[model samples]
Target: MESCGMSFIKYLLFIFNLFFAMSGLGIIIAGALVLADVSDFSHFVTSDLVGPPIVLIVMGAIIFLVASLGCYGAIRENYKMLVAFAVFLIIIFIVEFAVGITAAVYKADFQETLKKSMKKSLEQYESSSNNNIEKAAWDNVQQKVKCCGVNGKSDWSSTPMSCCYKDKMDESDQPEEFCVSGGRNYIYKEGCYKRLQMKIESNTKILIGVGIGIAFVQVVGMFLAFWLAYTIKKEDESK
Candidate 1:
């Protein structure tokens, strides 16, 4: 009966290692997608805001490596390796919990910070003829997000070319004037900051979910690892 139970646990742990590894891959993909989405409006945010996603990606990679160690330890019935694996899982759990909390806090302050950032970017945008990172990022967000200025079309001193329908617009005739919502060249009425904010908030959900899911997986992995280690030690002592 003991041999049967031990074999069952070994198989279960091996299977769980596979599941844990896949969870890690999911986190990596989630982080990559969120990072890509953020890149479109990168100029509107400080570089430090990217830290959470990067940490997720790095943690995911570490999980993949750790999962392998767990599988090896379980299959080999190595008590020491299983203890080490449990320790690593505990460390990862703590970090993931902190990241999730950080992300939640960041979300709470996101709107105000984004609004300020957008205002700063708009102030630096100056003109349609001016080419700079702010202009470039703003233009991309306007087109991709189907949004206008910081608040709305009126936030601009004059409507930006990005707010206009490209093919229908005649820059030669009105350059940046006819985009005030009257004709075919009417600008997008929505605000870039709001649109981008929604996108960012939505993406943050993915990160949060990954963090929560990984924490659960880590806890289970730690439990199974320690239990297996104890079982293996017991069997060795009886011998």
Candidate 2:
């Protein structure tokens, strides 16, 4: 006969696994948001910034799958599967810990990179004639961020129409001379790099917080899995 304590533990483990699986979905959503946030700064930063979010998405998928196995094992009182689930939770915890640390360490380096790369990106945007897509993207970013250029209006000898404070003034309606010599009194005064750096820091903090929070939960899960597995093993040996 199963002891009352063991029965209680079994139900508790099942419920915990259910919660873990749901949290996995939350992590995935958090990762997606971080990835989207990185894209907003894509014009200034390299592809390396996407790494943490990608890792989080993959880890969350893994957790969701493992939690299913854990739930099944807990319900069936399967010792082997319970042990496997415990191992997976430990592996996930280690991965999250490593990723969180790496992201924290690289935050300053990435901000420096963003600052250094801005001028080069602006130069590329300016020199390319087939940059309609780039132009539109930049205009959207500029309007949303309310920033003039990499540094200021002075950063552009030919600033885009979006830089001008006039609401939806037609670019073609401008004086030919104004178009040719693109400095305008209405140009947005703030720099984009500074504003974007603040964005990066805020989004990265959210990512790291999610990873750490999930990792701590996994630690609790690992303990329960191990305890339940050991209890089942002891019970079997005595039979």
Candidate 3:
């Protein structure tokens, strides 16, 4: 009977360690995906800054080590090893909280920057390009401008200055240039990139969901590892 109990405990410990180690790996991969956001910074007040990605990598290392220790400790019935694993879990919990808070603060800053960019874009439209110049004369205005995926080259090809929406007016209060190409309505304005804003919003929500799920998984793993460690010791005593 004692031998059976020991074997059962050992099996539980092994399963727990295996699942958690793989979970940690998944979290690490997700963190790498978040790091990829560095490529797009048009809407950020602060850059990707390297801090969060580095923290995530470090967390992955901790989780891997702790999970390994839990497995080894359970197999060997080593109390010291179990304690070490618990310590690692505590440290990881603290670090996760800190990183999460920092990200929230940064997100607020980015939102402010996005709002400012939109206002700047509106101002630029009012001050420049009254839409009166011929396509040839206004090539420069149209060149730097993109609305709904239409550029100056296509804008010139259209008749009666068909490149723009009449709703977008200039400082003189006349209808400004708009484009209906690319299956979306758009007004050409400086300092505004809605694509970047949309990207930030979408990514932020995804990251938040992923973060919560990872934290929950980690916590559950920690408790299960601790319990399994105890079970292993109890079996050894019975034997």
Best by TM-score: 1
Off by over 4 Å in 1: 127-131, 166-184
TM-score of every candidate: 0.88, 0.86, 0.59
lDDT tens digits, residue span 8-94, model 2: 889999999999999899889988998987776676564777777788888888999999999999999999999999999988787
lDDT of 2: 0.80
- Who wins the lDDT comparison? 1
Clashes of each: 0, 0, 2
Residue 212, model 3: lDDT of: 78
Pairs clashing in candidate 1? none
Judging by lDDT, tell me the better candidate of 1 and 2.
Answer: 1
lDDT of 3 by residue, 1-239 (tens): 53665567656766777776776787678667766663334222334534555566567766777788877876776766876776677778777778789878887675666556544543343345563322232333233232221222232223223234445444455354445755434454432234455656666676677667767766766675567667756756777
Per-residue lDDT, model 1, residue 139, is 76
Error of 1 at 236 (Å): 1.4
Clash count in backbone of candidate 2 = 0
Per the 3 Å backbone cut-off, how many clashing residue pairs does candidate 1 have?
A: 0
Model 3 per-residue lDDT at 64: 74
